[model samples]
Target: MERENAPVGPGDVVALVDGSFFMHRTYHLAASGDPARNLRPSDGFPNGAIRKFCERLLGFLEAGFGGTRPSHLGIFFDHSRRSHRSELFPGYKANRPEPPADLEALKPLFRDAVRAFGYGCIEAENYEADDLIATYATAASARGAHVLMVGSDKDLLQLVGPTVFAFDFEYGVPGRSGYRPARLFDAAAVAAAWEGTPPERLGDVLALMGDQTDNVPGVPGIGMKTAAKLVAEYGDLETLLANADAIKQPGRRDALLAHAETARLSRRLVELERNAPMPVPLDDLLLGWPDPDVLFPFVNAMEFSWLGRKLGQLYQVEASSYPSDPRFAAPVAGSGAAGLQALRYDAVLPAEGAPPFASDTAHCAVSAMPLSMAHIDGWLRFDFRSPDLRAEPGQGHEGWKIHVSVDPGRVAAAWDAILPIVAEARLQAKVAGPALAGRLGDSSHRQAGKMLVLYAETAPDVGRWRAVLTRVEEALDKAGVTPGPRVAGDR
Candidate 1:
């Protein structure tokens, strides 16, 4: 059944995992050293170390898969001591210590354990796991299979392309309420965040700085920042070396001139071998189900009770033993502020009034029209009117009478209490109706007399009214309009 679904397709993905490096790192962190050292224990076994290590790997894989499973999975391990890179740089990764005795003892066990889980494992003599992964990734890409390389190593950034992504599995923090898959750092993302240099040139950049962790000797004295800057300017190590004299700083120039050979070699060391042999075909890389019964025993033997329980829970959930709801209530009230407020309105002015421009109006026609209104149901509304007393355009168009209505019945004393609030919240007199008054003296006013209409809404919550008033004031300020004095109640 698993074989039927194993073939590579358009959406099929292959996971090129660095099993050897990951296991060594995890084991080192979990178990410091063998309790009994080199001498075998009385039980005639090499301690139960490999079992524990396998348990951790199993747990990580299970969690990595989660509810959705990957189409293909392949674990690449480092099998050889002399990789092709060694020929280019004699001192490539030469300074690292050998794997610890206990971990070394369990290396074979780890390989067997990966196989037990029905995953295709690959290792080439003298080639690092990275080379094997690069080889598989290149092959998978050529075969039209998407590849997700799962590792945090910065060197893997080179493999990221349209079809290939790098996943940093170690950075997964527990209890975070999101499914943050290992993000593939592409060329653009790397350039933007990592000193603005392209991912392909990252190797050349690293070669100049030298990775101390990987034992690659970069140019002495130059650090990451300088290397990035030099690469950004000169493009790569070859050009930078050729134009050594062009470097402005004497210190950097001297460093580059002095360690040109080392920088070149370091570049070779950091470069991934894309043509290495892949043992498994891209189609065979599809993930297959491991015997859960066998897997649980392995977890139990390793004393990983937590992992065992988690596996059981995973299986149960997959079997639909757990009930889940699609319409679960969200944290928001109704999507967000949906049920918070309802709109309402009231009238403070008479339905029929003077045409607002009585033909024979006098100069003192500025009426302080006091209109009082309320939102009985905790709703508030504001109506403002600015009348031109002077028959002229620009001269007397600045003054305005604002009529604000408050729901006196809804909130006791709301009328008296809201008056000061509204007064404080009124628009600036000069700015209130500036646009309309600007045309006051212009001949356009005879055709369309300037009038200021201010509208406001009130709620039981003073904060809501205050917010609305602030918004209105801001709008008036932006629009370059000034308001007139406010009046209450309808006249």
Candidate 2:
């Protein structure tokens, strides 16, 4: 990965993010009280998905495959609710409920956020993230670049091959204590996951096995295993359907014969379109250094203090010293070394140490380093020990964690109220008291006994901590989650 502001060359790595898959997935997790989904700005915009996506983008850039970084990256999204598949079959994805309003509201910001970080945001009016990714991957791979598709959609594996791979990006691995590298799938790996159906023939397999999620109508009685076996024996969907009578299994043969045309339609639905119009030139996506002038205010406004600090270190500027309001400031033309020097000075805190955040009750100034940030952990112990529960300390009073319990059943309902504090204050949390059982989507109805533990870092004392807790209380109050009696160690 040669990322020195040069053109994307042969042998360079290209990473394409399936932005739509991640946003919807994050929304579902956040709606269930997942700590990572709580990012809300002062303006109350839904930014959790965007924030997490950006974090993963940073992680991907930092942790390239096998010590090789991606020299080019693109964030691809679906254009709208409908696509060519929907046009081909009105019943495509018809089973899904209407998308949540918050999720829809966050769509416009996806492009803005991606551009702010200097990555390409690609889309086509009637194509999905998968299709656009396929198009880009094809083009980039043709240019001799290895393509890394960052997404979990099985449909993407169709593009996995010698020059292409697919994987999902997650901030925290479920039930894991530390970072877990995602399993990258090449042609062989895709085949293994699909029961010996190779990547190229996956469409043929899917053609026989209808996808209920997408409402693609294949041969009614065929399943993944049977479909894979049939495709392997016949070598393709067309051949398999043409010779349905030869399948000794009467039920399978009859079903295939009855649904031959439907199977072809299903194959079309599952096929990736490799020629969707490019929204931007491939050369434009070549990795470039992020401009601090635009990057600093954007993260600060989103109240992503920890990320701001991390990026500040990379760019050598105090991101917090920039305005708290978000703005994509255009770079000053030819603002050479002298101009950057002045901006860096402006980003520097006063010689007296650190400046107090102007928010009401935001009085403490703490070091953003990991060692000092660990002081907040001494506040208490939790019932569970998952990586998502850990607090990410920030530089000011707002960068802290406060642990509190809410009835586990109320966690989901109270998320709306609780989100702002989590984002604005950059807090972290956990679930304690009792284990939640059953599906979390029905969490509001479940009579769980566990308590939700919300935590943060950077609170220097009990007073500052209480000030933050007061806001949480007000939010929780709105959601009808009254504070229980204080725990023994509570200050």
RMSD of each: 28.6, 18.6
Clash number for model 1? 25
Model 1 scores a TM of 0.55
Model 2 lDDT per residue over 151-220, tens place: 8888999888899998765446678895556677888889888999889999998888988888898889
Off by over 4 Å in 1: 1-5, 32-68, 170-184, 292-491
lDDT by residue for model 1 (408-449), tens? 122212232232223223221111122222333244334122
Q: Which predicted model would earn the best lDDT?
A: 2
Report clashes for each candidate as comma-separated counts: 25, 9
Best by TM-score: 2
In angstroms, how far off is 388's CA in candidate 1?
A: 99
What lDDT does model 2 reach? 0.64
State the C-alpha lDDT per candidate. 0.55, 0.64
